[model samples]
Target: MGVFTKFGVRLLLALVLLCSCSIGYESDIDYSLMPVKQGDKWGYINAKGEYIINPQFDGANVFTDNGLARVWVGDKCGFINKKCEYVIAPQYSSATDFFEGKAWTVKPKGAPVLIDTKGRSCFTLKNVRTVYNYSGGLAVVVDDNEMFRAINTAGETVFELSGPAFVTNFVDGLAAVQNMDRLFGYVDKNGKAVINSQFYGADFFLNGKAIVRADDMYGVVNKEGKYVINPQFAEMQQDYNKFLIKIGEQYGWCDERGKIIINPQFENAFPFFGANLAAIKMGEQWGYVNKEGKITVNPQFQFALPFIGKVAWVKSADKWGLIDEDGKFVVNPQFNDVLCSYRLFIPVRNYVVSEYFDVEGIISWINMMLDGNKVDGMTVTQTTISGFRKKYNLGEKGVSVEKKYSRDMSYEIYANGTFYENVSDGWWGTTTKQLPNARLDYVTIQLKLKDNENTRPLYDAVINALGGNNGKRGSGQYVKVKASPGIVTIYVSDKQIKDILNDNLGWSNY
Candidate 1:
């Protein structure tokens, strides 16, 4: 989805705050140093409780390497240094950081244009609609005609390719692109068709090979676009070039040679190679494995994230915590929401910065889950998600919920505030619940809310209302729930969010 478009729909979506861990424990993060929201914006305050930058901007983008930032001033884009200097004037509509010394930006409603450290337009990027950050010697741009092309450091089209096609930039020497026949293939930097357009799908070349799909079967090919392994698996998906495929929905990873590095016993597996670790799922839990396919961290997390910086997130029951690479609890999965930290700075207009960072925490988990299912680097809601919450002491609760949805539905566990949907409502649901008392709160609920025609998105509907996404929910601009809270009070902005907690709970009215 286009970043701004998603941002638009989400602008009104509610934010949530989950109390995953106990309040205090020594953390590398000075709890006092985490950014704070001042009314409608996030501001930087040191442990001394002083605003490093005045609490003013609408949002703040995470700082980057140069001690500079991209902040939005009103609707214009600009850059600022840590000293709070507006180094790059806020004049454009949107902007990104400097890479190889040049940043890509766009005028309001305009295509992305390149600017050097001096902030001069490399050229008037006349027709392209969207762009990617400059990387690996090229930045992909989509023209007015919707063709994908690349530009080099000199602000010249080093290469160009036509579409209806993918904007996936070349990784290594190969990029994934669709052909005239609409089948996906790999292309070399010289625009040569290194891999034939024979696969129904293919990911960019990574390490040395790419996974190609024809019909529903999968296989591997080397950088030269040669079939290193013929298509055979019933299903295969690529992660940074390595393959994670299924044999009857069981997943494993394989090298370009089709050698299964991680065996096919996992219910779910990821090709995210970190340190020497990989993540795999079995039953309802997640664990870590080494390149040798040895189970390193036993499947224990309710849902796990690929390890980054030796810390991977794990969930046991209703809480998520962090485990180090050695499978020891580093930051135990106890915080209701966990946020990854970024520490560099960049130049941004004041308004953009205000709009960016203030709401980042709430979207972290939703984005993490979406990253796993993203088709290409592009994120969208195409796959259906459904699950059930086992009501305490209810013998047939699971069976009853399953019978309510499509038989193909795959589910994980259910806890308080779990969003369980049937076939009737999709992933962005109109059905959900809040089980503050863990699984003990047995509240059978249904919400059919329509706030602007279609039912307000169910995920955004309830979650937004609950204080799930940093609790930045707009007043009454969400799903009107009619629930029975059993434990913690329903809250919004920490005010015991009471849009539906009335009559029975009688906390407050909407």
Candidate 2:
């Protein structure tokens, strides 16, 4: 079995976090400077939505512990200080956020180098295919030989594992390692196994206990290699003071001693974050439950996120906004999408621009379709036709269905007759049998202009928003075509241009 299968779900979550450039020492994060997006540019904004750092960079990340933020200038990545000055120039192919006053950077066709906060190269690591950030004075690297090793900040190998083993960064003086047999155990700073590799999985130790798996079930284990709570639950995730457990596909809460605090009843649940309340899904709606399993917030939101500080991001209908602890809307639901980081800033995307031919409007629509994964509250390959109709309050007469060659299907929803949505499905013919519940493969909005109206301005706007015909902004390709006289159609889909051509939609390269 692969390492992912052996590590199970919790380790997969940790791996995903580790893979991101924003991964850092959480306690050292400075939330005062948060990254926000304005139009097509990124900048730092305060809690009050005031622009602290003007929108200039192509991309921006959260401020690390050392008062530096990673930003992208064109295709290069660098670090900038709070004063909007370049602390580290845009030179690296990619870079991770600073942790413990040091960061890892990769040069173009060069070895990965560890750099100090002042942009001085400490050392270059060779023969390593993968590198992790330094934690607890040690970092983990996977060598070209596919073996894990621990290295010091000086780039000297502290110790190499005895055999092929998967290792994690040092946490609390120990690191979780998996032996060749795919059994996990804890190893000390000197690479000595303190806990025997017997369990199917292991997590980083916290508060003297680590979650482990045995008999294909999860439980808690102490640092001394003894089970504190025997493996019994199907899954276990340690939150602040409670453990989110799964039993037979349902989620519940349990205390530290494995005492059930809440029955496994909800369809899904989120861990408590920055507050005592956690979001739980009941049927199709989401609500919050306190530590005692009391429903503090009723199930009303279309979607909900974990609480951060005094507020949480929630979805009401198709728009997202902020809500207080009592489930009251502190910020009205008006944004197409909202992103929060470090509980300090909110990046709002307003895709409903008034003029479709303007630069800002075109950019907003492009970002919404490509980056935001949305097209008028419907996500391709996720939102079913029935759900879309229900969400938009579209009746039978509002939507017109068309079967293409008895293999592909399309749903057209008209809005005031000037514009209409073309929802496509069954391109591969597999989804044709799943009508009504079949998810949309792609969506296109067609606009009918006035008699003899020029389409050049709208076409140019789309090209500019997409960073020219080369399509540099995102991976998705867009095609602008004049289907008929006085009718202009712009198709935006995650599918490639070649794949769209295969659909025989009569679209030509611009």
Which candidate has the highest TM-score of all? 2
All candidates' lDDT scores? 0.49, 0.63
* Model 1 stretches astray by more than 4 angstroms: 1-93, 117-120, 235-242, 315-321, 332-510
In candidate 1, what are the lDDT values of residues 5-113, reduced to their tens digit? 1110111100111111111111111122223345665555432335577755655554444455566768776876667788888887777766556677766534466
Steric clash count of candidate 1: 63
Model 1 residue 232 CA deviation in Å: 2.0
lDDT against true structure, model 1: 0.49
Question: How do the residues 99-186 of candidate 2 rate in per-residue lDDT, one tens digit apiece?
Answer: 6798888866456788899999998765566677787788878754567788888888999987576445666677888878878898
CA error at residue 45 for candidate 2, angstroms? 2.8
